[model samples]
Target chain A: MLETGRLDHNLGRMGERARALGVRLRPHLKTAKSYDVARLATAGEFGGITVSTLAEAEYFLAGGITDLLYAVGIVPSKLPRAARLVEAGAHLTLILDSVETARAVAAFADLRRVAFAVLIEIDTGEGRSGVLPEAADLVEIGTALEQPPYCRLQGVITHAGHSYAARDLETVARIAEAERSGAVRAAERLRAAGLSVPVVSVGSTPTALHARHLSGVTELRAGVYMFGDLFQAQIGSCTLDDLAVSVLATVTGHHRDAGHLLIDAGALALSKDRSTADAPHDYGFGLLVHADGTPFAQELRIFKVYQEHGLVRAADGALPFDELPIGAQVRVLPNHVCMTAAMYDRYHLVKNGALAGEWTRTNGW
Target chain B: MLETGRLDHNLGRMGERARALGVRLRPHLKTAKSYDVARLATAGEFGGITVSTLAEAEYFLAGGITDLLYAVGIVPSKLPRAARLVEAGAHLTLILDSVETARAVAAFADLRRVAFAVLIEIDTGEGRSGVLPEAADLVEIGTALEQPPYCRLQGVITHAGHSYAARDLETVARIAEAERSGAVRAAERLRAAGLSVPVVSVGSTPTALHARHLSGVTELRAGVYMFGDLFQAQIGSCTLDDLAVSVLATVTGHHRDAGHLLIDAGALALSKDRSTADAPHDYGFGLLVHADGTPFAQELRIFKVYQEHGLVRAADGALPFDELPIGAQVRVLPNHVCMTAAMYDRYHLVKNGALAGEWTRTNGW
Candidate 1:
């Protein structure tokens, strides 16, 4: 379920922050996969968005959003689908870090008789994917993209994913700076090689919110900020109150002796994302809240989860059985909203303490 | 993807094991939520299956499998849907551990004028859910069901989920015995109270496979055994060679300096379940294998994962960069198949090293 008021607040806050940072806020739609959420997120801004999958690209393209960045590294097998999107009038941009993928994307684009705006993924200290800012491969990939008639080297993109591990505001800001500088450096390297480097994209939720400046970066991308979660809250990205999405579960069983309340929402409902485990506050699976989205006086957390059952318990080993009887409705704030939201096909929109309507979302590739 | 040959082998082996143990194998459809898999699993059985959600209950019921035990504890809010299944000629059985839920179930059934087969879930060492076999609530819940004109006391059911943590076959066998005795004892307690007790179900993958005898148990329930995962293989429930399900991923990027190969399958594709973290051999995210389902010469494990990217590294700290270049297809055996399989909408059936067909699955409640 999603709280529309909080959703709007989050979207507005991020948009305002991005405007302040002087960059186009390409809201990553991977968190809130709903087109309705996308419409609200991109309202009063450039319609370009960031997606993790070609499926999301296709969904948003069909929903009428044209400009999109397929943020994850491109594999050859996915090119046909990306090509289809591009042919459908989507300004679909693909990212790659290796010369092999650069060649493959070029070959596929040429064979399909389509053009693709390609970006070189720059390593911004995450070490997950992307070429390092100082690596020779950075310019080599940029040069390779230049050789293909159908593949245009748009710019360089980097994500400071390691910013999520930041325990302090100072660390976040530092990572954010590194993210900005790395992307900019890679873009400058491409430009020095006599190539066009139009777009320099850099951001993650932590980095985006904490970044002091994004000097050379043309655009910023962040996804999880829209639906703040327990992990984000713990890491100081967003406070607990800023969380927009939650799992609406029914109290199914009460274990008085064990001081546990069983909810219908388990691993599948509330995803198996234990991201908050290493954080200052370890919400086992999720933090439990009342139906009206109010936190209890005493802290309650889902201690354990099965496929379809969540074992909830209070911090003090005391449960208010009378107050929270079987059949009572409660909402669980997930550790990671992106993982949790992926389980449901639609979001029940909650407004003014009641379900207003439902927003459908696309899932799976 | 699902290997058809191994799927058939798993189904046959489990069936023979259940028959030898003198109990009905009510194969849990929660793991492989496919009508095609259910058809093969119940080809020669009584056609009864267990489900973790009402969605699966409805899906399987629509697919003409009428005997379904909605294995998860049923909340009052979900009764209307459960009633619809019962009304649709499904012998849908609901399980509960508390009198609160029992009263609510009975009240809903009486109000709707629909009969529901109710089972008292007995806690057989796994304190996740279920009433203890020795608890007074067991008979009380049975008595509550008897008072309702539309609710029938079917029997007792228990799952030894703690068997997953057992390192040896002896421990699993011990847990299996406890699971059987607990359910039988609960049934005896219900019968002693002059309540009709016809069914006694007990099982978990480890417990089911290791149980020497299930004398009093009428049927056994196990799901993940059908799609043996890394965690299961470690716990001795099934061998690694017996694993029938794996996520098909494409090599998207190669971080030669980092000694990591990036796969398109990450947290969303291959779930964030770290069930094997404490095991003897911790397959970080998942175990990578060849596209033809063959193991690599050096053990390659996905060490880190992003939303849509998996960072794979070999145990020897060396990657076969030349052999496993960009765009190469590989399969990853999940840490927990139930969690991993839920992310996918359909399973690409692989038989004899070739794609056979696709099997669709139902997700969400």
Candidate 2:
């Protein structure tokens, strides 16, 4: 077994923070990727978790973790799997943005003869998936699906993912405001239309942390906060101190001529997700840190990656690169922790920079 | 068992035509994330398999899919795993660009009593991971590592991954030519220095299919052929028919105001790899096809995605989207097949749109 290198208080801290924030923390499991992390997230009062993949829902649901939300846009290819999860007695909630999905999901419910709770995805500002802020018919149609007596419309949810691309915290705050308002608006519209809207939710690591107050929001869905990434640091979501996750990479090479160091963490380990803004910063895949988690002064990156090798470029711009000793182990702060983390299968947990326990990541459909 | 949907052999057959043209085929396994597909590529006379993740290498190698080349740049975080693979007696080759990696590998080999064969990465014209065309001494130093002798310096490998962002087919082809020629030139210079460099490798799916000849190229590395994504079609690398892989999704809802369809595939299922290049045709997140494998003239995208829902926009630009009935199954062609395939734990094999068998995807650090 890979030795668990550190003790992690991320889940415990996140759960406590969620309680302090006054919202039901359905912590998105897409970030931690570890069953132990999810378990920790649920150990206190946050008994429910949010999952991005069906496999994650299944894994957590089977590992004695319950109150699951399969929080992807609902489609038909995975309805059977979703139905199976529901059949296995998972309090599974799925999200949808259209009527086509309603019909498909209803069909699955009819075939399986099980009732399902689904959230209507409303686009507050993220502009990814959801009904528009003005689209009341989306709610009507979704609530009308309750006529089927099998598919139940639970409430509405939105993700302020656009907060990640925020120019500053103010923009992130505005996006957060819009997201909660949007979910509240949809929920109110449903209630005004005489439908029971129980859950009003909004999420995003940025929005969740800085949304100010829950107000109309009953559930806060946020991932990636548990493991801070380079993008997170740039947006001022958390300081380098709060970054709970990083790829434990080994320094494999030194380019003496270029004054560059090569690492094993490449686009595969560190995802290819660069900041999607016009003025992208030079956090090469992530901040390359020393093994003890102290920041490495050299502005370095596992930039220019190939299938296996990371072309580490020093931002300090020295030449004849050979500085790092061979066989030194390093940690890479991923550009986007969510995407980078989704690439790995398990986490070598480190608590206070000491070996903790192994936390296996879930591979959800 | 998910169906192994049947694909028209037209595109895969074109791959055969490329083989006839003397362009050696070495398919990358990052796409599809399946061993069955790897076996098929071998059956298709794909010379060798290129892997981005060590999990893939372990899976293919253990499954008797030897002759594996981990296409990513080698880093230290994974050397122990490499040693394990070597100890298991798999003929694996690693890639790197700097002497630091060489020294690290050498030290690790010395400590572990394992010999790792490594290739010096070259930055052809792509400006990715690689030694410059003039870095001969660096290669000498790496090749001359005598202590503990952890790694053996093989030849050189380069990928014109940036070729994917080319303007047109001609530019892509030109980049492809430069990619192979640059590696060949570097290898020749190394050989002139009395270095016994054997492998002169080059690749990138776009460059692999477009290049006229390997010339001095000893091996060709290509992935994404088994599943031609929307990006490949944009670059004119392969036709829609050659796309062998897709996320079989179910329609979950309809966005009436935006004429959008909601799907079950979110970023977790489809991945977030938007091809760097803009395509000639408007292919959304993926090409939405009927179960029969025929595509519609209408262009649709899983445009705005939430955790569980994929918001698909219709080409018609009209909301109240009426044609697509609920409870229908659709195949989502990915923006990039490799990353998308990695999201799933297994391929629900489909042949002729009928259930074939479940081929599990392997995973680990």
Off by over 4 Å in 1: B147-149
Considering the two chains of model 1, state its CAPRI-style docking category. Answer: high
- Tens digits of per-residue lDDT for model 1, B1-365: 89999988888889999999989989999999999999999888888999988999999999999999999888888899899999999998999888888988888889999989999899999988898889977788998888556899899999999998899999999999999998999899889889899999998989999999999999999888888999999988888999999999999888777888899998999989999998888999999999999999989999998889999999885899888988899999999999999998999999998999999999888
The TM-score values for the models, in the order shown, are 0.98, 0.82
Model 2 interface root-mean-square deviation: 3.9
State the RMSD for candidate 1: 1.3
Best by TM-score: 1
Docking class of 2: acceptable
Across residues B1-365, which tens digit of lDDT does each residue of candidate 2 receive?
23333233533654674565565566677765567777766676644677877888888887887777887667676788888888887767888766656666778778888877777788887665577767756456545543434566677888888897786878888898888888988888877776777788888777877787778887777766566767777778766666767787776655454456666777667776656335566554566777556786676766655445577876665533455665577788877766677667787766765666788776544
In terms of lDDT, the poorest run of 10 residues in model 2 chain A is A1-10
Interface RMSD of 1: 1.1
